[model samples]
Target: MEGSKKGYQFTAGQERFRNLIPRYYANSHVAIGVFDISNKASFTSLEFWIQELKRYAPSDCKIILIGNKADLKEKRQVLPKDKLPWTSESKHPKIIEISAKTLKKPNSILDSIASEGLAVKKARTLKQEEEERENERIQMYGEHSETPPMRRRKFLMCGSDRGQRK
Candidate 1:
């Protein structure tokens, strides 16, 4: 709660955020962590949220680092510290600067978010592969029935030879 300082109201804002984030994480496939580049307090708050998530996030989770409020370019102050693959400083997270006010490079944010979505897709694929192997193991031991669940078969097509959909 940061509102205690100079009517910032970040405390109220953060409460509203904490309430909404879990529902979003549950209903959506992706989560984004955003912050204001010109406002150090906002960035600090984002860092706190990231730390809280580390204990509960799944292995497949993806996180994006952003430096918003690029319109306040003269006031920029945050730094990247999380590991990101695209960043030359791989030890630090990727940070993109943009502003909703002047709309400076806002599309870059969308592109970064898309990259995170790609990571999630890969995670789901690996999970499906592991499940398939488990199914195969069960079949080898003769514990499996005539077929796996139709839903699990998904593209396998229990008896049909239609192959997988493109």
Candidate 2:
């Protein structure tokens, strides 16, 4: 797909079996969760897709939530600003409204998705690098000691087999 300024090649494939996400979701960097705005059931079912994507896809995968059929705004069953049930505070999907049937520039959506995907990938990379550096520093200098070790305490054991006497 054509990104904001460049083109990115993707090995895109669709699986009609919704339950088999684990079998096909490996190594994916970007996942687009599409739902029909006119169909409330479809919109509600996006949670399943999101959950499956998060569980099965790579840890750094970016998800884009699309509310399709923007031209059918009059018949929309799902609102754009409605709070989704499955969104996570730490990893919220980028929700966008689009009408493939009426859009003059389809590349705009592609560009947005691509740009967001790249941003997510870059952020994850930097985070992983930072974590590695922190780990290396810990290995080199050891973890910062905050408190002294507690001394071992002696404990008396009373056992019936030993016939304990006071």
Off by over 4 Å in 1: 1-13, 16-23, 26-29, 79-92, 142-166
Candidate 2 regions with alpha-carbon error over 4 angstroms: 1-20, 127-166
Cα RMSD, model 2:
12.0
lDDT of 1: 0.58
Candidate 2 matches the true fold with a TM-score of 0.62
Summarize candidate 1's per-residue lDDT along 29-135 as a digit string, tens digits. 34456788777777766656554445345545566666677777577776444333332453244466667788877666766666666667667879889999888
lDDT of 2: 0.72
In angstroms, the error of model 1 at 103 is 1.0
| Candidate 1: RMSD to truth | 12.7
lDDT of 2 by residue, 45-142 (tens): 77777777778888777787788898997898999777677776767777888888987447777778777777776788798999998787677656
Candidate lDDT scores, in order, read 0.58, 0.72
